[model samples]
Target: EAAVTQSPRNKVAVTGGKVTLSCNQTNNHNNMYWYRQDTGHGLRLIHYSYGAGSTEKGDIPDGYKASRPSQENFSLILELATPSQTSVYFCASGGLDRGTGGAQDTQYFGPGTRLLVL
Candidate 1:
């Protein structure tokens, strides 16, 4: 099973400040993703990584940056936080399924991080 955890479950940041959200996974999955949940937009993908040392821009990657330093760690960085970015962020990990030997559509997600930018 995939086990993902996120740090700073709740955060309050100032406008134009910097915020870093961290995620760690123990499933050894090759794919990791960062997403933000909003009321109207639902869950929007901000960034994703295929593996360590590789990062990719997602559907909504304008102001967000992602990093995957190791197989178990992935981080989301907001260099200049804004009030519009305030939302609940989630980290997910998924990849090939050992049992099925096929790509797993099931993604294990972290509890979520609530960020309030003011």
Candidate 2:
């Protein structure tokens, strides 16, 4: 029953500025993730959280950051946005953690927030 929602379906920003993408879930899932989908990069994990009050760096944590203040909210933060970072960002939430021996996770992806850095 995890339903993920993202804010600002589209965004335009200047280089070196900051961009903040928001996400909210209603299923009380313990895991949340942020990913970027680009032309050739496919889906790249940017950051994730195991649960409320905890944020973990994901595979590509170089230009991104994440925060999970509660069980229903997770936010992705771009300290300094760049054109190279222009891409569609997605937020997901699930109850299971595959790496933790939990059942196969059913990640619910958001509609995606398209970011354009100029």
Candidate 3:
């Protein structure tokens, strides 16, 4: 099974400070993603990578950057953190299987990383 885990389950930062969050997956899946969950909105994708050394911006990639250095590691960087960026972040991993539709592939999620920008 695909398993994704994120570091720093919680974080606090001052406005305009820099923050970096990390993620690692054990399933060795080809696809990895970073997302944020906020009130009244479903999970929104920030970035994703198809494989090592390839990062693709998602719908809400603004204010955030991402890096995938290896098959198992992906990092999310907030260069200038703000209170509006405070939210619950999650990492997920999975690969497309013919049996499952591209959008229907079930992504395995990490526990979550909660950020608070003061």
| Highest-scoring model, lDDT | 1
Candidate 2 local distance difference test against the native:
0.89
Candidate 2 has its poorest 10 consecutive residues by lDDT at 96-105
Every candidate's lDDT: 0.94, 0.89, 0.91
**Ranking according to TM-score, highest score first:** 1, 3, 2
Number of backbone collisions per candidate: 0, 0, 0
Q: Which residue pairs overlap in candidate 3's backbone?
A: none
Best candidate according to TM-score: 1
TM-score, model 3 to reference: 0.91
Which has the higher TM-score value, candidate number 2 or candidate number 3?
A: 3
Question: How are the candidates ranked when ordered by lDDT, highest leading?
Answer: 1, 3, 2
**Tens digit of lDDT per residue, candidate 2, span 1-118?**
4578999999999999989999999877888999999888899989999999999988899988888889999999999998999999999988765556556377888899999999
For each candidate, give its TM-score against the true structure.
0.94, 0.90, 0.91
After superposing candidate 1 on the true structure, give the runs of residues whose Cα lies further than 4 Å from its correct spot: 100-102
Model 3: lDDT to the true structure: 0.91
lDDT of 1: 0.94
